[model samples]
Target: MSTTSTQPANSRSRVITASLVGTTIEFYDFYAYATAAVLVFPVLFFPSSDPTASLLASFAVFGAAMVARPIGAVIFGHFGDKYGRKATLVASLLTMGIATFLIGCLPTINQIGFWAPALLLVLRLAQGFALGGEWSGAALVATENAPAGKRAWYGTFPQLGAPLGFIIANGLFLLINFAMPADDPSQKSDAFLEWGWRVPFWFSAVMVIVGLWVRLKLVESDAFKKAEAKGTIRKLPVLEAFRTYWWQMILGTFLMLATYVLFYLMTNFTLTFGTKPQTLPEGGDPATFVPGQGFAYTDFVIMQIIGVVFFGIFTMVAGPLADRFGRRKTLIWVTSAIVLFGLTFSFFLMPRENPVGEGTYWMTLAFLIIGFTLMGLTFGPMGALLPELFPTNVRYTGSAIAYNVSSILGAALAPIIALALLSTGGGNPWLVGIYLSAMAVLTLIAALLMRETKDSDYTGDAGEASASHPAP
Candidate 1:
């Protein structure tokens, strides 16, 4: 504690706070687009003669970001590993802000025709590129400052940004929905699709400004600084990460699979299902007499907020659990839970109505609780787990690429897959649930197969340090 007093502690706290807040903003910007893709993009950017095709089109563009994420990881990973986490963090945020703001300014399909979607894909790629570097930088800043024994616990703090970012992004969207008039059957939803949909995108500019201010306050990590002092940083970080840490990256990608699916199910698929009249439970009958009647969006928002809180709580719990029981045990249990919950969620909880029926409220609560709880377990330990798997010299690039690459496979396509399955399988949540459950099982198997790295030292030379750290 006394190694570097006054200035160092103050600077570290500033750095951690900035890292957390900046990533939170980045996630929010990225998530805002995700929410729009599920809720409004079909109408705003990809309207088609056929309604189903329009939804599919929106999802295609949504998939575009996921596909671009791996590319972003490679490009950003090179810079992050070669340079330093701080510079990459700043650059990623700046790029994300610009892309998001451009998304806001885009004219609808009506104005720009097919070019609307084409240009939307480009901006989405930019968003993916920026986000690829943000999380690794944030994680490094927080974990590098943590006390040795408490690294896992402190590491969980940066990961909290994911749920927190979702809270902000979805919370804002809910607020806008309440304030706006898109809900009324008598009113023109077109008005919102044309102009109001842009509000969230436009609001991204504030996040960029605030994010830059906070990020600039951060100092480089002690680990990275030391590596620089020794002149040991990798020139080709992406290649190094793949050559040495590919197994960890693959494991992380799989481990993250269930968590990402759960998130998209809650945030995107639920919104799509909830708003669709045909999917509503109880034959499209509005429960106007119910106590919480006429508060459809409100209920979903409340449930998700509760889920986010539990996400934080479980993340806090995961740290100690990982320390006591080990990362493998924790991840295995969490992945199993994801499978079990996915079954219950996809089978019993999904709303059967076109627009979500009132009965769907209970399902929403069930899914929220299950998803958020598992999310806490998996995501909480991952911050420590990923970095611990690699050496400090390539830690940033290695972990960032792994994490974002997983996001591409697990999260980026989740909504599209869910929607596609629904369209093809007559809205059978069972099938979607089954698919998610299988991925969770694979994750559990991956966890079981990995060697435990909980007792490894991360402060030494790459080879010796990693030998001690191992894989699990």
Candidate 2:
């Protein structure tokens, strides 16, 4: 097998399309559940006399999927490393699509009692399991097939799925909300709780079909083919990955920690905090009142959508910048900014004394834009950086483990921890900001400890010798 087959079996268009479409669908499925978790699940799946308890229960189920992600990573990573990227990518997409569609068809708590939440948990785990494998495979497909010196730029295609999926999922929900007949435009309609929330999940089936079509047409990248020809493919990549590259795995996990924490806080925690009423409800006890900006749900989501636009734009921009300046330098600067951004959470998110005033709304919007801009800068480089941390033989397993473990540490607990901190701080977001800043500081340390991977060899069997070496 000539390792010099410069012409790949997959066209550039196909490579980009397959990776972008598959992840877009997968993220769409995940974000659909995320939106519903805040809006509908607490009411429909986990009914409680205490609204706070119900919301917490809903978030707990949301986090349960993170526990399953590492398991998915191990299973899918094994097959991805041993077999090839194409089959594993397709399988992950199918599993996620099926799980998402089934969640749409599930009975609510009103109809099926505890079983509703139980079934929802089962499907949510399946989604997490599929996603564990989804991101790494998509990243590999883009980076492994990239032209020389452009891997980081190619890598951003998969990362682009995050903002695109968020936009589509939230846009669909916003449209559904607007179309529904709500007695109060600020509150959720009965129709939205009963059935409208399920539309995004079912719509995922159509997207899966499209993703499968593109991915099925994909051929193995030359990097993987060369690795196989050299007989470097391990029978058990996960064991080998842990045995040899354990430090890389640890570094990669913490490298991603701030990104995950910032992202979930931007999306999920913001939704909860933004929409909570500033004043107590009529006849409500003063003791239980939680202060918030009191923006209507529709209005707050629109603000989020605006911020996510910068996320998408900056994600594309980070790729070229990373390629030019090196991943380590780019991440160091961005992570430092994230640390600073975390300190200002109270300054931006604090509601004015008049919560409904225009000044409060604009301040919240500014906070979102800045946070999401940082999100894009940090997230874009990770596609190339994580996979670059391992040899081609175990790239899938190594990168997937790092990414998913961070999901547990960062994403799974971010919303729950933020909410707890919010309550602990008497509804002020200073504590939540401190939490984000603390996570960014950890990521910054990890970045400083890691070597630059901009020029790492992708086709070579030897991993980066200096990967564990501290940056000067």
Candidate 3:
């Protein structure tokens, strides 16, 4: 097969569909866990001796997957570079689907003692491992088959999965949370904890069936086929990637800093912050007022669902914009905007004290809209930009390493770090904002350093892949 971007229309559509569906299912699984971590895990899994400690424990389980991502990248990248994108993609989807379904079946701390959290951690790691491999395969297939000026647009199909997954995950969790209500403030809601949370996890088994049906239909990326035909496949892509493309791996990880920081702060940190009882300021009496803003948890989830829908729309818009403005340039602008968003996060929307009026409601909406809009613009181009940094031979290994390592640095620990900061500052959000701003600066510098790869040739091999096969 020719590796030319001008493939048949039917194949192109199938490739794009495969990419979008697989990526969507992967993200949906992830975001669902994140939402649950804030709302359910603390109560169900950890020692409730201290609120902050339990919350930290929940986040640690969440971060466990991030820790596994780079390892998954190495393992899966080898097969993707040697076997084919389609097979690796299918396997990764099954890995995630099965892990998620199992998570639904696990017992809570009350039912199974320590085994509950231990089992949950294992499944979380599996989910992380599968996703580490999943995104790169989807991205590589889409871009490799796309026409020259259209790779960025094609790339967004996979990136678009984040917000689409976010909406579905948040929506389901929201509905589940609503199914059981807290009729008395003195007691917790066991209805949701007992059974409502399990519904989404079991549904993942069905989602896996759909994702596999679509992904299994995908034709291999033309670029990979071209390399295999020319006898240029490598057996040990991981070593080759490190030896030749270490700089790109490093820079790509740094370039993703702002995006990783922004999302965890938005979704995980905010939920924890909003729902945790607000500490009374010095000299204030608790007898006269409610602790925290008293914002409804389900209402906040609804707000997030609406915000994520726009997040998806802007991600779609970013595809065409990147094709026109240049990937590097567009990323630089979007990241710079994120810096401004970080600096103003508290001033414009979140109330420093109890929000007693309608004005605070509008401010809260403003905060989410601005943050997600910027998230959409910046995230859309990443799928195209990361793979473009490497040649076809090491593209899978290189992009996988860079993308997953950044997850460890940013998303993996973001909620934990933000919680510590919040606890230290007595619930002040400024520390978290500062952390987000610093990451945006790193992202800006990285964008400035990277070369524009929108027009790079994907059909060529990198200096004869050693051994016509690297060691497996």
Model 1 lDDT per residue over 431-470, tens place: 6777788878888888888878787666544443333333
The lDDT-based order of candidates, best leading, equals: 2, 3, 1
Summed over model 3, clashes come to 2
Candidates in order: C-alpha RMSD to true structure? 5.2, 3.5, 3.2
What is the number of backbone collisions in each predicted candidate, taken in the order shown? 17, 0, 2
Winner of 1 and 2 under lDDT = 2
Best by lDDT, which number? Answer: 2
- Please identify model 1 stretches exceeding 4 Å from their true place: 1-12, 182-191, 279-299, 350-359, 462-472
- C-alpha local distance difference test of each model: 0.73, 0.91, 0.82
* Model 2: colliding residue pairs: none
User: Which of the two, 2 or 3, has more lDDT?
Assistant: 2
Q: Residues 98-148, candidate 2, lDDT per residue (tens digit)?
A: 999999999998898889899999999999999999999999999988887
What tens-digit string does per-residue lDDT give for candidate 3 at 146-175? 876888898999998898888888888777
Model 1 global lDDT (CA atoms, 0 to 1): 0.73
lDDT of 2 at 151: 85
